[model samples]
Target: MSFITLNITCSEEKRELLIAELSLFPFDAFEETETGLLISCEEADWEEEPVFAVLARYEVECRVERVEKVNWNEEWEKNYDPVIVEDQCIVRATFHEPRPDFPYEIIITPKMSFGTGHHATTYQVLKHQLQLDHKGKKVLDVGCGTGALAIMAHKRGATDITAVDIDEWCIENSEENFSLNGCDHVKLSLGGIETVQENDPFDIILANINKNVLLDQIGAYSERLKNKGTLVLSGFYTEDIADLMAEAGKFGLVHQEQTERNRWAMLALKKE
Candidate 1:
């Protein structure tokens, strides 16, 4: 299907917030730019009122255009580059040659899915995962875009892994990536955390979604976590950490550590 592309030019200070707000809509994918964000959604899902309202509120320059459907693979190949993190993991596409030096190699075919280790949030999360002990643990990957994090957990010896997302395309893309990386054991589900049974708590939860979504679901995450269980969160600016931590503290989660890159932050917390 063809899509509407919103090319927005706003202050870098407002970029994260803009992306978060735009995410609330049916916008399925985002591409960050030097000045602002490039967002895409199916034409049928595009509502001019909300888009114009957000732009007006932010007071940003926006250029709206219709993008014809084309070969997504070719588009990605032209733009997507392999990402290497901490010299430990290499996230590449099927078109890239093997890098035998890296301990963990992830091959993903990112069609419309998000996570590819290119974004700062995804990179920091992958770096943190390198230091974690995932062996035989019950890992839950919330907002499992492209199933990158879940596949990493599986490779790290996590036997019981559940990856959930609200997007059906993400589920299908993640399944393809899991198979590509030979991690078919990772359980995939559609919808949010509520779709998963609450009978058994998880040893670790990876949520790489935006700040607003994190705040709204913090309680649920806390409830689903086992005592002393780890929670890693990203997809927000570093400046938002204090507010996020304060909200998380209300749910009995203690801040452990954090990592930042390019003004983006990933926080690690433990259930007290």
Candidate 2:
């Protein structure tokens, strides 16, 4: 299907508000670029409407431009290559050759979903997980896109692992990757944090979702965690750490450590 690409160049100060405005359009995907935001939408009925009408309502100055459409997945695979992290982990798409000596190996097939482990959120989670005792622990990976974090937990000797993603496609991809890595112990589920019913009081919980979702469900995580359980969270800007930390404190979660990579922050907390 051909997609309508709308490129808008605006000041960084107005970027967030412009994104909030454009989100109302029938956009299939949008990306934050160095200069502005790029939004792509499948052809809809409202072709003639001035996009500036909405932008003007929000007092945003943006330029609209058109671009040719191509299969995004194809373009992604062409650009997808192996990324080595911490000199200890290797991540690669299916077509790329992997280096052999990395202590940990994570294989990910490029899909529409996120969580390649190269993102700062996933990177910090993986690095933090390396510090813990995963041996025989029951882990729950919330928002387990591509099953990256859960697979690592299983590799670290997690006895039972539950991985969930809100997107069905992500769930399927994660399950496939888990099997690809010979990790049969990790369970895959398609749902949100609310789907975490069968498992409770987990020893470790990994949540690499955005700040809003994390804050809203912070209490649930604490309620479902065993005493002294650990919670690893990411997927937020560095400025958001203070608010997230405050919310987590209500659940008796104390910040143990944190890491910043590429302007994103991850927090490691323990339930007291």
Q: TM-score, each model?
A: 0.81, 0.77
Candidate 1 C-alpha lDDT tens digits along 169-236: 88999999999988888889899978877779999999999899999999899989999999999999
Q: Scored by CA lDDT, what does every candidate get?
A: 0.87, 0.77
Best by lDDT: 1
* Per-residue accuracy of model 2 over 130-179 as CA lDDT, tens digit each: 78899999999999877888988987889989888988878878878888
**lDDT against true structure, model 2:** 0.77
Model 2 quality (TM-score): 0.77
Q: Which candidate has the top score in TM-score?
A: 1
